[model samples]
Target: MPHSNTSQSKGLALPPPTIVLVHGAFADASSWSPVIELLLERGHRVLAPPVYNRSLAADAASVRSVVEQIDGPVLLAGHSYGGAVITVAGAADNVAGLVFVSGYALEEGESLAQLQGRFPGSSLADHLVYSPYPTSDGATGTDVSVEIDAFPSVFAAGLDSTRARVLAVSQRPLSADAFGETASLAAWRTTPGWGIVSAADHTINPDVQRFGYRRAGLRSVTELDAPHLVMQTHPEEVASVITGALAEIG
Candidate 1:
């Protein structure tokens, strides 16, 4: 059964908002494993869905579908590129709030390329490996992934070596087109938001995270001296942020 918590403002009981976790580029829903375990233990209903990493519009639509299926309010939390996905998806009527964990918070008419370009410190560009794949229309599409040997140091710096190695090899590549697609909506403009900045991040550049979160005017901003994979290294802290967002939503 779903967890229920009382809304002090209405003086009535309501089911706690479901947390929808969206994974970013070069990663799958499994990236949320540790955080999911913690949220579940606390009785929060959590769904960590996989984003296609194909394009912003398509990915957002996919997640919005998931949110609309839920019975009650939902708190959409996304990591990395997943952040961009939720930025557009969180506009769904059922979405109550957003939590950006080492994620992007883009504005309308902006693309991930545009946002990242504004801040120039990320080393991710240098480490990316691009390859061609066949698209549905029989045309070639480009997939972007980090070099296997460089993935651990760049994307999962704080994670255990053995686990990081496994993750490196199992990464989900993002379509190159996603970088250039502009976001049709900026949900944070209307939705309440909170953010966690991985201060020592190398994958997306900590400054990029800071700039986006600041512009979004998120309700709360927490900075941790962690790496790009803050979810893996600091699951407890990430869960706390989500819990806090839920409290505010109540």
Candidate 2:
């Protein structure tokens, strides 16, 4: 392939921006494993930081820390509630773009709880199981989890029951407050963005996903028929979208 003058000027077609992936509630950084490999194969630097689902502010701070430590421009991607975290963290100086994979892109002062019902396709409320825990201030806090039996139907409908069962058993619960806490900034307002909206998503309504993308003025969107765990179920599709965002911003 012949190189463009732009590539020569940059010494090597400006390498793809580093990708920082943020996993959502009920899942850990491992959820991004498949996508991570795909991105790596394509010669992209990737990082997945573990987010403490205690509060939006705390989660955003964690993501921001990762973004800051990255040496160059960053492409920030988030799944599920992690979308909300990136919405705040993407405001960092290093972030070049945002990618929302089955994520909620809240406006300033909006929250996951508020966005969950905005389009009303979620069946999550019906499948939740709550347990009490101690908070930082020593007060009681409620942690919400999905019923193991209902996990396949509500969060990973496309996966086999056996696989979904394992995921459910290993799932991490999020603090009830994380969902209710309001976001202070909407990074999508200033950052270029891309979205992967899962058509069969029951965790975060598909229509709501569209609404979020539209609200964020995303550069483009790729829709998949997979469920909420689209990245796990269709890693190639999700990886392609991330690479697409890199190309768009580059």
Candidate 3:
């Protein structure tokens, strides 16, 4: 049977919400590929949208635009920096709930830098490579990415070395400005939420995930003994968390 919600007044079944998977910095929508495939096989409608990795506000706006266009309710699950993006974007009226997968769940007025700084254990800073990119205004802006050689260890730990290397070379870079920009709104503050903490994460400290999720008062929190790329290394576990959230939402 298809997943659905019950209408209290009409005795009708509302269609299951479309799941929107948002990838974090240093990755694209493809980062959700493993989990996406699993979700699809389980008869769920999913969309893994690209995050521009520009500025928090811009990225959140871009995601919000996508959510706004969906026909029914949306279940947003974000990984890494994408968690921050959805923290802002999930405020949409159609957004029914949120899932944070090895992600940073920021509070209102908190910047990614602020949140990560508090935990102080991520190896991501040491492995980051910054390069200058020209902005639309003809100004030079900094783009931050994981160093290719170090990406496999720092970001994709536990994945096949060859596959990790490919991800390293093809990684998307996030704007340096995104680190300092404060989230104007925290959707998790209002929306029902679920979270997953990659206990072995090196990109973002597991403590950071725990802290944010606790503050958000999420409905459920799962801790996985996985690395930063939990979606790839533990797709089934990640999918289970999402489907669990869906079941509860229904």
Candidate 4:
């Protein structure tokens, strides 16, 4: 492949690649603040694309919009449910690599519903939904408040009081349909992979994350002794992992 035109210039001519950070359900871009700062410190431009789980298809379009605005290579990553979105969002042209932070790495047509079917009575399932309601896409919606309650152990078990409080107030409603929708491609299959395993994650089982990432052929792995909010719990380590992934490609 031809080098980007700027690569031809002498010193400082190689412009930094853009690193797009996508947050998972029940939270927004703020989740990646610490991690994003670390990436910026290393001289890469970071883009945290905001998305809503209820708006699954719209999330894809929003991701596309973010990718279009950038002029260089993209290093895309997502936490939790956000992982599925980026698999579709950055799995295409120009995406250089991906990092999955305790996220569901799915294949085409696979939704959270389908995956959770393996074990339906986990804390999350028990607390979150009784039955689905109609959504804008003619699909079903869920009750997300139940998510925070059921997975509190997995997510905020060890968080600082201040951060934990913020988490409670910031958690948003994620749509039910997004979970059941499978990704067209596992971006990690094409893009080099980095997986963040939160050993104590309750919201998403740690074993599940490990299994999915291994199936994707990830060679670079980092384990955090945190809860479900892996990135939020230990952003510094997570940022270092992101930097490590860049070193592999750079």
- Per-residue lDDT tens digits for candidate 4, residues 1-250, read 2243344443335456778898887788988887877777877788897886665557876786677556667788889888778777765566788889988776566666666565433446555643456776796666455444444554566777767766876676677656656666566767788899888777787777776787788867787888877776688889888888887878
Candidate 2 lDDT, tens digit per residue, 1-250?
1122345456764444789999999999998998999988978898999998899999999889877766567899999998999999998877889999999999999988888767665788889999999987889999999999888889878877887888899999999998889999999999999999999888988888899899888999899998999998999999999988888888
What C-alpha lDDT values do all the predictions have? 0.91, 0.88, 0.91, 0.72
Specify the highest-lDDT model's number.
3
lDDT of 3 by residue, 167-218 (tens): 9999999999999999999998789999999999999889999999999999
Candidate 3 regions off by >4 Å?
A: 1-14
- Select the stronger candidate by lDDT from 3 and 4: 3
- Model 1 ranges with Cα > 4 A deviation: 1-14
Query: Against the hidden reference, what TM-scores do the models get?
Result: 0.94, 0.92, 0.94, 0.84
Candidate 2 Cα errors over 4 Å, as ranges? 1-16
Give the Cα error of residue 179 in candidate 4, in Å.
Answer: 2.0
Candidate 4 regions off by >4 Å? Answer: 1-14, 119-122, 129-143, 147-154
The global Cα lDDT (0 to 1) of model 2 is 0.88
lDDT of 1 by residue, 81-100 (tens): 99999999998887899999
Cα lDDT of model 1 overall?
0.91
